[model samples]
Target: MEKDLAPKYLIHKDEKLYFAFAVIVSIIGYLFLIVSIVGFIVWLGFAILSMFLYGLMMAQIRVNGIRLSDKQFPEVFEKVRELCERMEIRVVPDIYVIESGGALNAFASRFFRKNMVVLYSDVFDLINSADDGELSFIIAHELAHIKRNHISKQLFILPAMWIPFLSEAYSRGCEYTCDRMAAYYTNNAEASMNGLTMLGIGKSLFKKVNRREYLLQSSQEKGFFPWLAEKISTHPPLPKRIDEIQMFVGDSSSSAFRRTSRAMWLVVGIVLVIFTFAGIGFLYSDEIEEAVNSIVLDANSITNDVSSDEDSTIMVQAVAEGDIAKVKEQLESGIDPDIQDADGWTPLMWAAQDNNVDLIQLFIEAGADLELQDYYEETALMKAASQDHVEAIALLIEAGADPNMASESYGWTPLMTAATSGNLEAARMLLEAGANPKSKDGDNFTAFLHAKKEGYKEIADLIKQYEDNVN
Candidate 1:
């Protein structure tokens, strides 16, 4: 940990803080697990199996991909060897240059003890053509990840790996550390910045981009969605990484990392997914088969589970759970389609939540009341229209559902609900189905006004068109 391969001045200041926090939480979690020996043994077994399967998958990937060797792609191979020598790494990772469907990216991977580097063909082309050591910076960046043992340490801190912002912050800090070392290795700061900029914009556009204005614009962009997206991401965003590279080159000790771009955990993810489904299928074979069979909407399976007593409970429950077969069976056994629960919500109302067209048709054919209101005084059409369920709205309207039916709370009619929610298709369906666009909600806002207030310009425009045609 004390050995410095890169200059001490370039390393990120907060990398140690975030790593230490995760380590502390991991230690606390492990100490509590010490009390439950059986549970610990089960977890240990599962971890071992996952590692074994994922290691095999990585080995297969290395064999299948085009490997860079002494005879082919020798320049890239030499860079790997050179970086390992400079970083004091004991092993030189095998580098593979593979075509990634025009993806301009690269990744560092390790399985068991063998490390591998994957370079997309386009990134290799871009880096190979550059003269200012951008290729060296990219190779050195991945090498720094190996030198720091970022991948291996995740096992010990497994408990804290999925804890919301904590692990993601640790990962972003690791990325900053990598960027600093890479910038230090290249020596030419602007070239290293260009290498990162190439990742954000494509290969053809990096030279023309004004870095200062780009950074300023990205910094000024603010909202809850952007903040939440970065908080949940594993790597710092490309612009943030570029800013950190600038700080590193200037020997500034401050941190400027935030947000994320592409993900890097893709190497082992495919193997884990394959083994997860395989393990689950093997463990629950019978239950899985039964569940699959129960959902077959054939006439034979749908009419099988008839009850002797005429009870509405099973039919209502089946409709709520989306078990179409069970619902049909209950209906065939003489249960009422308009059966209400304690809250006066019918089977049709429960089915409306998912906007199931088949279920709605069955209730309509059974002579269920289309205008029936729940405890909240909302019709099935009101529920469907607000969600922009166009197919459901069309079917309900064709079956004579009241398009103008209003719910109790805001007295929001189906058309007003669709407009307020910015559901353009649902609003159009309601309008075409003869819903009155001029009708007002409890707040005295018409559907047109509702669309305008909610910033739905297209919906407001459509409402205006309908009003103009009427005039």
Candidate 2:
């Protein structure tokens, strides 16, 4: 039998173009930096800051997160080693998982010669809930970033970061390249899509989300705001990301083609406009400098006279305090119920975290978004479960909350939380409301496993019974 050739999903055209654009812009930035000794000093400061920050993060991950090794997280360690061999990565990067609270994200970084990958605990848990292939796609994605030496490349282009849209475009291109590499390494397009979908919605709900309809939603996001948002974003939107993966697999008939094509033209148009402005600025340097100085002065004058609104802060505080009257007043005054505080926590989240069932009801009645995640990607139900707030959990479910909804960061449904905390009543309530007992967390531990591990015999027995009944 003849040997089969591996499928080749090469570097995307946009990736190449954007990278070239970034290099050119970086060269120009370097030229500008060399024009003045102060500019060179500023560039040096930025480089030092970058190195220091990465080093600090590396230290934090080592100290606080679990390091993958032969004994600890052995399965993931094996995957990492296998991926490195397949990708031909010489120096296997150190991988660590830190407590992310509820944030579901991962990143690969380098401090001088030391390359490391930091996986958020919740994001790492995807390995258990989804197929290991999905986790492999994610790992390969990060490894692809390291293998491509993207961090070092960006370090050289540090000066280009000052360029408004150009740097963002280049960063987005790098992301697409890494995504392609991840998909190629895993050789599973659907797994890759599911991984990205998990990042967007979380683990439990991702399966229920229609991938085709989700991609179509991107087409409806037209006009300047959406276009400008994409142009200045560090990563392409999730739908576009899925499209890029599809393109790699030679599936070009979908609407992703149209959206991606539009995005490419938008990038080209923006780049042209940026270069034209740069040309004008160079041709009329003195006039541009004068206008910039005037604008800065005006901005300072306006800043000094503006007073900040404290109403949102007060509203959030009232919700946290469970002051029904104050909450009612705020709602009556037409304050947005969905407004997030500084930490991306809405008033409803505050109420849920506080386990105030009545306050939750009030917020719901006032049109609060039940599914809103805080900075940690924790829904209200997750928070309630974490605290064993039975009444709150019952109320949330009665109000149409999905019992199977999992946090994107932790991959734990309410049932898992109840099991971990040994809250038997809460676990029973969740089971009765249709929560999946077999649902796993980021670590792949199901509610049953959590119950067993925690010595909650009753809960474990209940879960076993539930599984048996389902079977």
The CA lDDT of each predicted structure is: 0.72, 0.76
Candidate 2 wrongly placed segments (more than 4 Å) = 1-9, 257-471
| Per-residue error (Å), model 1, residue 107 | 1.9
Reference-based lDDT, residue 179, model 2: 87
Number of clashing pairs per prediction, in order: 1, 3
Listed in order, each prediction's TM-score against the native is 0.51, 0.54
Residue 122 displacement in candidate 2 (angstroms)? 1.1
The alpha-carbon RMSD values of the candidates against the true structure, listed in the order shown, are 23.7, 25.8
Count of backbone collisions in candidate 2: 3
Give lDDT tens digits, candidate 1, residues 1-471: 122443545446445545555555566668877988986897789788988898886777787778888887777788778778877875677787777787778778876445677777777786446543666777778887876666756665687685667688778888888888776665566777888888889777888899877776777768877776866888877888888777655533544444343233223242344333434444554353244234431322233222211244566768878888888887786766777665666778777768888898888888888898877787888878878888888888899898877776777788887888899999999999888878777878899998899999999999988877764
